[model samples]
Target: MSIYRTIGIIGAMAEELELLHRHAQMESETVKAGLVFYRGTLHGMNIIAVKSGVGKVNAAVCTQALIDLGAECILFTGVAGAVDSSLTIGDIVVSTACVQHDMDVTALGFAPGAIPYQEISVFPADEELRSLAVRASRDAVNGRVLEGVVLSGDQFIASRDKVQSLRDVFQGACAEMEGAAVAQVAHMNGIPYVVIRSMSDQADGSAHMNFAEFTVLAAGQSYAVIEGMVRSLQQA
Candidate 1:
C-alpha cells in the first residue's frame, strides 16, 4: 500500500478554487467521497483540495472536516489586502503567525488581537512548513516575498482607516477572510497548517474598486507559490 499524505487547501473565493482545480486532472473517482473534495498531484505528492467557503466559521468547519478525514497539513491559500505599503499587488505573504483582528474583549482588559480568554499570545505557523513556504515564495514572487502576520475576519477590508487600525493593533501585514480561523482549528486538532497569500490590493479605498480586476490574477499567483511549496514537501 502506498503511504498517503493528505494536504488540505482552503480557497477563499470561487476563482481560487476553480484555478486550483484546473491544475488537476478531471478523472472520476480521483475526488474523495462525501466531501466537496478533489484529488490531484503536486510534485508527485497526493493532494486533497477543498473550498472553505468564506469567513471564520466556515473556515473552521471546513478545517475540522479535513482533519476528520486525516489531513496532516492544511494550507489556507488565497488573496489578501496588504496592510503594509511596502507590499504591493502580487507579493506573496507567508505568515509567521495569524490574528483575528476583529476579536475584541476590551472590557475584559484583553488587548485586541489577544487570544480571547486565553493566555496564549499568538498562534504560530508550522515552522517546517514556513521554511518551505519561504523558499517557494522566493521562487514565485514578482515583487517581493514578505513573512509576517495575516489578520483574518469576515469582512473584506476596503478602507485605509480599518487597514491602519489592523496594522496598529496586530502588526499584521496582510488581511484575509480565513487564515486565522483555519490556524485555530488546526491548532485545536493537533494538525499543522500555514497560510500563503498574495497581495491583491492595499486595503484602502482603491481596494474595492480594484478587487474585481485583480482577485483572480492574485489568487492564481498565490496558488502558484502554494503549489511550489507542496511540491517541495513531496521532494523532501
Candidate 2:
C-alpha cells in the first residue's frame, strides 16, 4: 500500500468543479496562474483541486502550479467525447496513457502525435494510480469502464469523421481538450499522474447537443470514481 502525501485534481468545467467542491472540505483557497486552487482533505487524503478551464495550454499551466504547490500526484477529471463506438454517455474512460492529438510534425519525419526532441509524445500514467483508478471506476460507474489511450487537443470534437481519424491514428478510447497536456506536464515534472474522463457524448454530428444534456451525469461519474480512488488511497 502506498499513498502520496498530497494529491492535486484538475477539473475542466463548472459541472466537474462543483462536484469537487462538494466532495472535498477545502480549508483555504489561493489564486495561481489566474486559477483558484482549493486545498483540503478528501476522504482523509490531502487535496488541492482546481478548474483549469478547457484547453491544453491552460491545463499545462495549472499542472505546473499544482506541482509547485506540493502536489505529489496529479489527477485530471472531466467529460469527453467518445472515440470508441462501444462507449455511450455515462461510461468512464480511465487513461492508460494520453497523447496530444494535434501535435503534428509528420513533414519532419516525426509521427503525427510525436513531439520533436522528446522520447515519445504519448505520456503514460502512473501504474499504481491507474490500477487504483480502474478499480474505483468499476465500483463507482454504473456504465462500463475502460482503460485505453486518451487523445487530447484544443478543439472540441463534434464530427464523426474526426473521431474516426483520431481513432485510426491514435487508437484512442476518447477525445477531450486537456488530459494529455496535464499528462505531459506531470510526466516532465516527475510526478505521478492519472486522467479519468467520463463520456458525455459520441464524437459525432450531434456531439454538442448530447454533451449539453449529459455533461452533469458524466461529471458525476468522474467525481465518484475520483472520490473512490482517494478513499482507497487513504485506506492504503
Candidate 3:
C-alpha cells in the first residue's frame, strides 16, 4: 500500500481540476479560505484536489489548506507556455525544480530569482514522485516528456522576449503562473511535492490565441499523466 494516506492535487485552472474530479470516486466538496477542495479516491488512492484560482498567492493558500486537511504529499498539474523553442503543444514537462522568474532583488545583491533569506533560487520536486511522473508521462502522451526547470511568475508569458529572458536566466522548460509558488510552499512545509505541466502554447505573441485553442487539450494530457502516476503508486 502507498505510504501516503492522503494525496493533494492542485491546478491553476478550473478545467484541469474539474476533469480529475469527474474521474474521482466518492468525491465530496468543501469550501475553505475562498477555495473549493474536493475529497475523493482515484486509482484506489485517497486524494484531495483543488483549483487554486490563478497565481502564487492562490496556489500557496490552497496548498496550505490541503495540508491542514491532512494531505501527506502534494502534486500540481496544469498547462504551461513552452519556454524552449523545441517544446510544442501537448509536450509534458515534469518539473525537477521550480523558480520564480519575477523574484528580483538585484539591488540588494541577491540574484534575480533568489527569494529573500533562501539559499537556493530553485525549489526541487520530490525525486521519487518525479521519477514516477516521468515514467507515467512516457506511457500517457505521444509527445516528448521532459524533466527540467519550470519558471513561474504572476504574469502570463505571452511574448518571445519574456520567454527568452526566462530561459536565459533559469533555463526552464516551461513557464506558468503557479508552479514555483506551490513548490516553495511545499518545500517550507517539508512535504514531498511534484509539478507536472503540459505545454498549451509557445510563449510568443500568439500565446493567447494558442492557449485559448489548446488549454483543454493540454489539461487532458496532463490529467492522463497524473492518472498513470496514481495507478503506479497504487500498485506499489
Tens-place lDDT per residue, model 3, 1-236, is 99888889898888887678778885688899989888889999999888898999998898889888988999899999999888999999999999999999989998889988977769999999999999988998899999999999999988888888888888989999999889888988899999999999998899878787898898888788888888888887
Q: Total clashes, candidate 2?
A: 0
Q: Each candidate's lDDT (Cα)?
A: 0.80, 0.90, 0.89
User: Each model's number of backbone clashes?
Assistant: 0, 0, 0
lDDT at 181 for candidate 1? 89
Q: Of the candidates numbered 2 and 3, which has the greater lDDT value?
A: 2
- TM-scores for candidates 1 onward, in order: 0.91, 0.97, 0.97
Q: Mind giving the per-residue lDDT tens digits that candidate 1 earns over 1-236?
A: 22238777778678887766777653332233334866666656667778778898888888888787667888888889999879988788898998888888887888887776566646799998899888987887667888999899889899889988887778898998899989888888878888998888888989878878888788778777778877777777
TM-score of 1: 0.91
| Candidate 3 lDDT for residue 184 | 86
Candidate 3, overall lDDT? Answer: 0.89
Q: Show model 3 residue runs off by greater than 4 Å.
A: none
**On residues 1-236, what C-alpha lDDT tens digit does candidate 2 reach at each position?**
44689989889887897887986799999999899999999888899999999899999999999999999998889999999989988888889999999998999999899999998689999999999999999999788999999999999999989999998898999999999999999999899999999999998899867888898888888888889888888888
